[model samples]
Target: MSAGGAHLKDEGTRRQVVLAGGAAGLISRFCVAPLDVVKIRLQLQVHSLSDPPSHGSAAGPVYKGTWSTMRAIVRQEGITGLWKGNIPAEMMYVCYGAIQFTAYRSTTEALAQLDPHRLPPSAESFISGAVGGGMATGATYPLDLLRTRFAAQGTERIYRSLGGSILEIARHEGVPGFFRGCSAAITQIVPYMGLFFATYESLRPITTQWEQLPFGTSDAAAGVVASVLAKTGVFPLDLVRKRLQVQGPTRTRYVHRNIPEYRGVLDTIGTILRTQGPRGLYRGLTVSLFKAAPASAVTMWTYEHVLRLVQEMELAAEA
Candidate 1:
């Protein structure tokens, strides 16, 4: 193919990946959204430091586990609680997934085209995933922050509703409020995605050799493995990110709410550790892991299938 033709082809494929990734994200978000709500609730729980827990604030109900959290949400806020902030979550997912896959695919393809003989697939995936994850997080961060706040709000809404939340944040906290935890988000997502993709690439050969599997199945398996490992390593960062996001809309003039007014990523980290203990950083680790496994599986499986479908359609069109 001519250079111009090749460029067009590359762009076309990138767009296809974007669409496929968006579809995958939409599907996966719905599948795991309840768990997502539960996880955020768990993460946002601020245990009182008092020995008798006598902070004068009503003691937040302790969620024993996923099932209890689900029960609590359903009982308190109805079934709708399971899907709190779903709109923003879905939007963030679609944008984040589409941008991530598009950038990752484009970068990887370009690198491979430039030096096919040098870099391995795992290295390529890692580099592309890292860059793409950072881009995706940065591009869709406001939506992410909004989603976190909405989910954390539940029935006792801080901002009353979505439009209210958006306007309130814009009016009170300004533009940067939308990106309260940008650094922490980037720190959490970039390496997590890089490691996840690299692990997936690394496992391809091993999985295929172990047993004959369908295209998307292997991808699903790899995604599950990668998600577990990556999530475990980086749960603390994610917890900190969530706290930072909620700080923006929930802060009050009378009393600074949202845990010591997080200065930055490191400050958030230290504060959580020093005050809440090491366990504080892993508050929602259980629910997060539960969400990660099936969510990752669905996302990767659907993404791979949709990507293949797109490729086939593109090839047919070209032919």
Candidate 2:
């Protein structure tokens, strides 16, 4: 291929990769958000002691299955409740996924150029994924907090819109409230992203070689496999973060109608362990797994195909 042709091809590939990643992210979030709602409620219930009158259920909150939770949320809150913070959630996923994909591809390319023989190990992918997740989560955490609150509220009140909800949170809790779960979010998301990329990159080649699939096909397949593996590893942290975000001062009352209450992430984890045990930490794993598998598979597949199409279109335009 001519130099100019090669340049065009490279640009097309880059565009395709970006589009694919963004699409995957968007789809994954939408698909799994309902399960996400369930997870949040399960986490929050651990801390729901304070709002005794409002929240009810002192017997440590009944452990409903995912379907039951979904049914209850829908019956109590309506269709809108299931979606909760959908707008911001979608935006976060799109932006985060796009940046993540771009970063991963660029990093992989650079590393490959540096040491072609040395494939990216889990550690390297972990670091890269961690950086991407941290950056993305940090940028979008405020929105995440809002989504959690809205979902947790359970149709008791109405906000005029997303802006109204933000205003309410700001007025009630001040600026810091928006960042309530930030530390835990970063902790959870960073490793989740890192491990995801690392595992996917490391495994893609092996899986592809063993399966004898095309080169890029392995990368796409790897994305799905890696997502599941990483999610399983980091799900507990996610449970913690959601709990911290949604629990609020109300959670303290649940912990101890007195005793100064639990403060911050460590306190909450310790309390849950004392009261609830390991099962407390993994309330929604089943639903999460169900949602995650197809979500990841579809996301990665869509992203790859989208990129391919975009590249083809770009090349055709040039031709």
Candidate 3:
């Protein structure tokens, strides 16, 4: 192919990847939104420091199975509660996937030009994924906080709309409050994206060759693997981020009542450990894993397939 043709092909592929990833992400989001709601509730549920007997006990009514949790939430809050914060969560994930994947591809391309031989495809993909995830999370972290809070609300206290929730958070906590868990988010994203892309890219060749799958199939498979690894690897950080974000306005009462207080990520972690013990840090691992596993699989699969279809259509148009 001519240089121009090659450029066109790359551009088309990039566009396809974005569309595919986005579609997959959207599907995944809808499928897992209920579980996500449960996860948020688990993360945000408060136990008094004075109630040391129940601290870190997984015996609570809320900490039961998914079906039980769902039933309780619906019974307590109504059907609409299951979809709380759906809009913001969907929007945030879409933007996050788009920005992260686009930036990753673009970054890889640029880096390849600088040192084609030294910068292997895997390395490029890893670096790009990390940078992209970080950038995406950073840009959308505030919305993430909003989504968590909105999702974590009691059924009776649920916001009428996304805007209403945002306004309420702002009014009660101020603008800076929206970024409550940003530090933990960034920490989680860096390693999560790094491992995610690294694992996906590393496995792509084997999956493609052994399975004889289409290009997108291999990509999607890679996404599942990467998501599992990354989520597991940074599970603790995710726990901390959730705790910080969902603490609500009364930090002094809910988080800690001591002199120093839970001002930041470290303090929050320390508080969780001292008060709730190790189990507190792994609060909703079950639901999170259940939601995340298939969510990641579907997201990557959809993203890659969508991108491939788009590319084929574009190619046919050119012909």
Q: Name the candidate that leads on lDDT.
A: 1
Residue pairs with backbone overlap in model 1: none
Q: How many steric clashes between backbone atoms does each model show?
A: 0, 7, 3
Model 1: per-residue lDDT, tens digit, 200-255? 77875566575667653887888899999989998999988887887753743211
* Winner by TM-score between candidate 2 and candidate 1: 1
| Rank list by TM-score | 1, 3, 2
Candidate 2 lDDT, tens digit per residue, 1-319?
5332221113245667678778888988888788777766655665332323323445445335678678878887687667877787888788777877777666655544544354435555676667767877887788787777666665445445789877876787788878886888888888788877777666755766756666456655776688788888888777777776654544433221222244677887787788768777776777777777777766766776777788788779999
Model 2, runs deviating above 4 Å: 1-16, 47-56, 60-63, 110-120, 158-160, 206-221, 247-262
Report the C-alpha lDDT of model 3 over 1-319, residue by residue, as the tens digit: 5332232125356667677657766788888899898877666544422333332243332335567678877887788778888899899888887787788777776775673244655666678788989999998898798777677666345467778878887898888788988989999998889888888778766777756665447766777778887888788788788777766554333211221235678887888888778777777777888877778777777766677778889889999
- Judge candidate 3 against the unseen true structure and give its global Cα lDDT, from 0 to 1: 0.72
Candidate with the greatest TM-score versus the true structure: 1
Off by over 4 Å in 3: 1-17, 46-61, 210-218, 250-261
| For model 2, the run of ten residues with the poorest summed lDDT | 2-11
The CA lDDT at 19 in model 1 is: 87
Candidate 2's TM-score reads 0.80
